[model samples]
Target: MAFDPDAKLSDVLAGGYDLNNRLQALLISRPLDSRGQEAAMAFSQELSRVFMLSLSMLNSNAVAPEVRSGNSSGVSAPAKDKRARSDNGEVVTPSKKSREEGVTRKEITPSPHKDGYQWRKYGQKKIQNCSFSRYYFKCNRHRRCEAKKKVQQQDGGRGRLPPMFKVTYVNEHTCHELRAHDDAAARMASPWTASRHHALDGVVDTARGGGGLFDLLPHIVGGGSAEENEAMVSCLAAVVSGSVPSPPPRSSGWPAAPEASASDPAASFVPPAAAGRSASVADDGAMMMVDDTGVSWDPWWSFCPVEEAAGHQLVTNQNHHRDMHMDDAGGFADAVWPEHACGAWRRA
Candidate 1:
């Protein structure tokens, strides 16, 4: 589990490690019944819908949403269906020259350095069964900071490109400085988040409710029962669901990250949604399995500027996905506000 922006620092410092353990357990530990599957599908749809909408919004701001925009502007859209969407909901035009067939090297290009560490390219390699070249870079600073960056072009066949760049920091000043910077920036982002965190701390003190941590205490110190676990999940689901009374409003300052714009050469590889029906259950199930396998709940908190921007963008894509997928059972692909339409989500 990731830290919530609205959680207190002291609370995090005290019980943070336990949270991760619980999250891991929750991910792989299947639910006793269809409840887990239902919850997972619901959760997956919500996440995918938000992601799709956000990509569209971001894409619209930077690139054209449809071919009509390209035609009106006298620029031709790319000739292939290998288009990807953005967190802002725009079409990403892939470069025909970026990838070759049957290559196996993928690169993780670092985002433009948020902190001040310059890098120099060192080498390139080809991996097996992938279709791109991976470029490697190292921090050139003599200050004992070892940061590495990997750059790869998009594979043309997947239709959606994986993240084009991945930056891994070595055992020195690499991520520490970057995380500290993010810490400071998050602290300064908004006073409301800070106040909310403080309030959450107060709630923990008064309520003594066990969220994910309740399960582990039994083995460590022998504390609770199965009922406690159920209560905790229900409580957390309620609380997390409560935090966002409504989706966030739009903001300036490019709410999404990495200076997203259509004109950028690297935009094509960022994975966004397509304009067809949502990915099928097999695909969604795989995505959910991947999500559970990864077990990174950091996005659950983290005041992600990108996620907020994506939430705004998703409003449109959710509608489209829902419309396209309505005929299916469970109707899990659609993003309908339960209170507004289905009357399922009662406000806390």
Candidate 2:
């Protein structure tokens, strides 16, 4: 469980802290065990995803869904899940990246400064013999928030990757920002999640009494293009039928955090079918659990940008672990765990 992202965060963190804990079960390192060569790296990546998600949710400056131009009504699209807007009004949905920089830089960032909280740079200094300067930041609300951070540049990974940073933090935050973020995150989790109660009356009425899955397609896909909706629905039907198969591996994985390209058909997403799918789930309700396997890669998984981005980047691993994850590992190799795995009514 230590290495599995699907486990509870508390469990993962606790297990990681143990000198020899359950996580070691995943470590099969042997003299020439080629299979286990990337185990350590995979563990690190999953752990990084957890840390990134947890910290990012705390960012007060986190970006909200960008309202695409055209909807003159200024009314938000029905599907809050999507990141891009199609001309006819559809976009592939995913947990959006924090446009806050770092991760969004070239869709891959060298900076790790996009933690959940808000900060303001107060000072920067050049070290005696360092090529990169040492910068400092304090909580955005310095008077009420006492947290401070020092970030120093690290060696570029032999130029294979960009420069990394050594970040040090002092003092705990008094901003109570986490609570605020929690509320916002819950709000964004999903409006159409499946739940028995806490569901919107209109949405619920529309679903159980409405047409079959086809009728529900547009609502779930967020109302953009027919192709987008059909593609999403096709995947959903396959998932519901138990045999859920892994998508064929692409030479290059889809962008973990993609910018909307109005010109691209694949990038176009339909409006959310919240009414059809989210019959009742409004917030933190029971997730659509198919198996107790601990990881759920249900249809909703595709729409969650946060989990989707972090999880898919695991493909960057040399072992092609992601391609094998669903059959051997969890499709996501784990999930948002409690955050997403348990979310959506919220996580999706």
Candidate 3:
């Protein structure tokens, strides 16, 4: 390859068939009307200028696209010229997982909840390979609220559309209160959201990890069992009591609970009516009578902060940053509303 020392850096970058060059071309080379050429060129130059400035400040440790060139091997080039497979075979798909490591793609399905804003469904789109229809909702509360949500039907595994769904909220809305209201309104609009509430009345359980985002598909298609129901109740109780199962004791001079080596009768007082009190609590909590017959199950572990228990399996650590939207209006108002002993609580 011949080098052109006097050429602009933008021209040099775009001349090579590498990821960086491809990206620059895609972002800067949009089709413009004949009269719009000057405006487009100015915009492209500005974007390139910004990119150059940012590149100078970044360390080599930053993840930038690896550049490569390919001759006519008859293989079609990737459609979007943004990213390419690295020489070391790193493939970057712009959907779903790009949200990992601090890059936010606003095009994803938005979170189902917003803090206090309301919205109404204005359209629905049928995307291929998506089992459920995508329902679109725009903020009905404030013109200032430019938030939208896409609701997709979750596949119900047995060739059916589960009464559950995956809701994505694409929000750039400034009105935090309206955002919250829109979140609550979305829940009210979706029938799948309603089913989750109904399911919880008999059995409410979920799992989560570091981020507040959860995968709820597991329980959606899989029907609940008697043992699962009992587990659900126990899990809820754990959260309420503020004691996630004390992580299995680590080896060391870990002190066990102090016991009565009782020469003193006062240290170990026996309750005269312990049996009656325990029964009454159980009776009150076990109102939704589903049969516990012929169901055997294995126990599973998850982290559920009482604060973040509205959705599925989630693990909690102080370092984990929950979505600001989740905290905006007490996540999933439908699930948390009218707090009663729905099931046992599990706390992480």
Misplaced by over 4 Å in model 2 are 1-109, 177-348
Per-model TM values vs. the true structure: 0.21, 0.23, 0.23
lDDT of each: 0.34, 0.36, 0.32
The sequence of per-residue lDDT tens digits that candidate 2 reaches over residues 1-348 is: 334534443444333333222224445323536555566566666666656543443343343233122132223335445364432467644333322211111111223333333345557676665554655656552245656666555434222122334555555665456434444566678534423222332232244335676457655532322223334565677788966433322113221111111111111111222112221221232223232232222323323232243344354332433333321111332222111111112111
Clashes, model 1 = 30
- Candidate 1: where is the Cα deviation over 4 Å? 1-146, 154-171, 174-245, 248-348
lDDT top scorer: 2
Candidate 3 structure quality by residue, lDDT tens digits, 1-348: 344545443343333313333334444456656645665465456556545433443223233231112112212244465553432578765455433322212221112322122345566666676644466655443556656555554443121111233444554444446534555676689856645432422221132221221233223312222222233445456888967532212113211111111110111111111101111112222212111221111111111221233223122221222331232112222221112112222222
Rank order by lDDT, top first? Answer: 2, 1, 3
TM-score of model 1 vs. true structure: 0.21
Candidate 2 displacement at residue 154 in angstroms: 0.8
Residues 221-286 of candidate 1: C-alpha lDDT, one tens digit per residue: 222223223334454566888851222211231112112221121322222211011221221222
